[model samples]
Target: MLGGGGSFRGGQDFFGRNNSNSISRSNKLIKSPFDNSNIPPFPSSTATATADQPIFRPSMDTDPDPEHSFFEPASTSPFTKSPWSSHFNSDALPSPADNTSFLPNILMGSLVREEGHIYSLAASRDLLYTGSDSKNIRVWKNHKEFSGFKSNSGLVKSIVIGGGKIFTGHQDGKVRVWKISSRDPSVHKRVGTLPTLGDYIKCSMRPSNYVEGRRRRNLWIKHFDAISSLSLSEDQAFLYSASWDKTFKVWRVSDSKCLESIEAHEDAVNTLVSSIDGMVYTGSADGSVKVWRRELQGKGTKHFFSQTLVKQECAVTALAVNDDATFVYCGSSDGVVNFWEREKSLSHGGVLRGHKLAILCLATAGHLLLSGSADMGICVWQRIASDHFCLSVLTGHTGPVKCLAVEKDNEVSEGERRWIVYSGSLDKSVKMWRVSEQPPSTFQRSPSFIPECSPTAGLLVNAPSFVIREQ
Candidate 1:
């Protein structure tokens, strides 16, 4: 059993019930939040400087009368007379609005849940979209509001939003597009289905022969296996997909035609991300990450593709890019997070280590990176002074955290800096935390909102098509 404070108890039962008769509460219970009695003693000094002995002093008057005080008492006490008294009234504590905007940079919010585990999440403007293993897709307005339309069918693995439409990849080897009109609640409709490459292709055509012959290309939707991941260019001109068939394909969304296909990895490509610099990065189960680039020909022909970069180790499972595109962060099943710069080099700038199990998801905002892992925890890291680093490990989830979404509050009032992290876990719940000067000492377990045995395991937001499934 995975418990708070980094302790793992195995061999009892997988269902989280302790069956050992010898187990005692004192032995099973980990450190409490108030256990701060441990402290190292300081060394004694033979020579000490007092207040009257100044290290350096000007020739002017440096002393003042002791009775001339510079302090005054505040109107209220910082702490109440009783600990429980503070909880009796909401007004007893200061509101978040009263704090300075630039401090306490981390905030968290929990969104509504679907019938199953959330696998992927995407955000656009005021809408939050989620895809789940329950073969359902759900949309919510802001963090507090929920929308009614949910799809029914295969597990939604990947999702992307573009051209006022959402595109979703399903485990059943289908891609559906949906048009979302918030103005009319009843206007949500499926628009089209993309091709699936579920089997082997026997024919190959040269780029020139197909373009000059004006041949209509078949949709690459025929996947030999399940669609594992999907990504779109910054401009949404092309859609790229990675599948269990060991091939990555690029499709033109307008025509729904396969633009190019490359045998990018030896195993299933589990994740894909496209950068603003026109580079496509794919992470595979083969324990490697590959980068693809598009080559435009002189003639008006389809774009040719080639591999430009690769990481031979670390089965990359998730990816996130920094706000400035200066760095790319890849999370792997090896429990390591690698950072790469944009210079076509294979060197890593920094390695974030701490997760005991496979990292399943990652999200980035500004200089901060958030990672979710199979170890049932979230780790936050920030780039310090451009080179140094600091980390804060957040423990809470009893199961693997599969997806995360970050919301940047650019319009927060002065003195109030704000950022929200939304995470989806296999525990069947979402959690919210308020970030302050000190990390929270205790991890609170969220109540399971979705019933057990739901197939929801991944999340994809801002996708056009929705999916919902039962376990």
Candidate 2:
């Protein structure tokens, strides 16, 4: 931390963009991340330091009595019935079998109160938000009633949370923005809309010079169909809306202005993910994955087509990128996850084949890649030392798995780190899975803490440099 109160205080300073003096929230700073400058030292007298110290007793649970041990165990692991029951064969990157273990488990399930399919999902401070076929977007706090926002338009298609705002794309071809009130976080205020277009009369009012006549014409032109997905840059500077009209439009977050409209796919654009480094990856129903690079042009940004990948003629259903953007994971309608390396030339990485049905969503955490599918199952894959293999299968969703989000545990040690996965399905429910190499305690792990994992460079690629040779 720059001022050394704590990382949270440092984050508050970073995210709030507040002055260094005001960002501390009254916490005393000891030193900075770089140079260790000291503050005033306390008096070293024993009488002065111990004068007001109060002694607190430890709880009975820690009294070292064998009777204090909690709960029964040793018979079966909680994950036994859930597919990711067994431990992994090894930590090395050797290829694993069909039933190979990744040490993942379905911790809990949060079912929506409304009877509709969940289409999209996002995670905030301590709650998980879901957009469904219904008019309401439900928020889940461990399946308990938290808070919700209602929509008047068509069904919700995609959702993203960033920059203290929630962005939702709908089937009605509109992107709406909502922000948490500084007074009450549960209360959201509708702040803005994207590509605000009017009918014949409203179109005439937009200044031709301000909104390019071609852009004004193309604003409503694209996204007349349902918005299938939404993504945001790591810095939250831009929001991307992908639609069934085979196009994706980029918008500036501050002023709510449309920047570029790209006819991204021959078929519908199903999923997209963007990075802070100005790279955008889009997958389409046309069975292709295209990378668009955003270049700074004067005061604004411009997206230029970089490369096209995957020619299997299978609809590219989902897309995922690693923490550092070294690898791209593309899932297809044929249940194949293709890996690509972003180097001199985009390397065609190896393929992960596990699911029997089309893949609907993909998420990455630590060295694990989770693929949700139309087969009502989720397959967990582990990458180690460049070896990739199917870890386990989680089968509980009654319907096709639509979307999922992962939060990794970064504060813990390597083997102890765990990531929480919130998955939304057409089964009218969202299931939470804790994927990790090891458990935290004998009891259940806490969900309130966020999870993070180290950068992984071990995903296999199909290129000659990544070939798998028999021992």
Candidate 3:
């Protein structure tokens, strides 16, 4: 945890011995949070730690007597009255920007866009997808707008990209699928939807009279509530959609078929993370983290309920798994990040504490665990071999940070790798941040901290289109 007397503790000689020290710190190596069979000491303001021993403290106070209960509650349902209002033409598409004029004074390395209430964001090899609370879902490349699509029914809550397709989860209880048309790259088609039920039979992508008829018959196969989040399998062959209806349904990506539905939690399923090897992780408002497995048995497939992590009684708000599948982060409404490990059953690692409110989103880039909170702040933590601790605190957004995505690229000028952070907030904008090795402030202006050239130094010029308008 970052301390009260917070002083920025980073910056070093670029390409010098001093860089070694910063790398060790950035690695965030430290003692487990649960050191002596108790909650390990929270990273004080004075020090930081790393991810090792997979130490997570199981809070006796947070975990009440547990029972096998997967029932759904009506009061806390994700299917409550939706705010979706149909307004735009279903046939009309988003037009290209009038010009490629760059936003004035646009921080070269850091970008801030004025897109509305950017709820969800995704990135492919070169293109970026921005999902807004409004009707538009914009696509950008090299920081310039490429194309966009719109949905009049609901706010886009979650998005995932795979297999040349974009899957979006909307508050209107629908999963919309899109693809860049082969015939027209500039035009993206609403290729398909999940649980199409009758729509599958209608053989049409757009809404039609049969939509309602198919919807009625699809109740059993579709999510009956708001889709909170979506995840794709390692091979992108399977797609998972979790809902406020306390259930998560599995779909076959090749055909948009609803394969299975599991009543996951007693409360709403808020977030989920998936591993490439058929491991599905789900966190719910019921304060539990359950693991599910999807496997193929010859020609047939199956989803097996695997394990559960009930470290706290607070709602599990966000989740992240490390790239190597060694550590699993389960963030709760009470501002705790619980760690888990693989190996058949889970290893109770320890909890990470810093946020004043619920943790809303998490992204693990290299050894850095970036956490966004309802407190309108993002905390960057380092995880090296053992020294784990907080590295920086970013404060600017007026609203809660809801989503985060990270992209890494080589910084040719700095001779190192740089991480560009893309954050989506209820504030209706997407902000970009550059994290790289830099020289100490006292010596000289570090090219990593702030560019000496244009604000887009350190290889941000290579970032895909969509620069922010200057304030």
Candidate 2: list runs displaced more than 4 Å. 1-103, 112-114, 197-222, 409-415, 438-471
Query: Against the true structure, candidate 1 has what lDDT?
Result: 0.51
Scanning candidate 1 in windows of ten residues, the lowest lDDT window is 1-10
Score each candidate by Cα lDDT: 0.51, 0.58, 0.57
Predicted candidate 2 versus true structure: per-residue lDDT over 31-85, tens digit per residue: 1110111212222211111223221111112322121121111122232221111
Task: Give the residue spans of candidate 3 off by over 4 A.
Answer: 1-115, 197-218, 343-345, 412-415, 437-471
TM-score of 1: 0.64
TM-score of each: 0.64, 0.67, 0.66
Please give the range of 10 consecutive residues that has the lowest summed lDDT in model 3: 1-10
Q: Per-residue error at 411 for model 3, in Å?
A: 2.8
lDDT digits (tens) for residues 1-471 of candidate 1? 000011011112222233333122222322111111121211211112235431111121112311111111111223212211211232332346653322242323333232456666666666666776655556555343334233443667666778878887776556667776566542455666666322223223333322211135433335555576777777787887776555677778776666676667655566777777676777765556677666666732243344434454444567776655667777765566777776545456656775777677877766667778877777765553333233355555555677776665554556544455666665544544333322122212223312121111111122111111110
lDDT at position 154, candidate 1: 64
lDDT of 3 at 72: 23
Q: By the TM-score metric, which is better: model 1 or model 3? A: 3
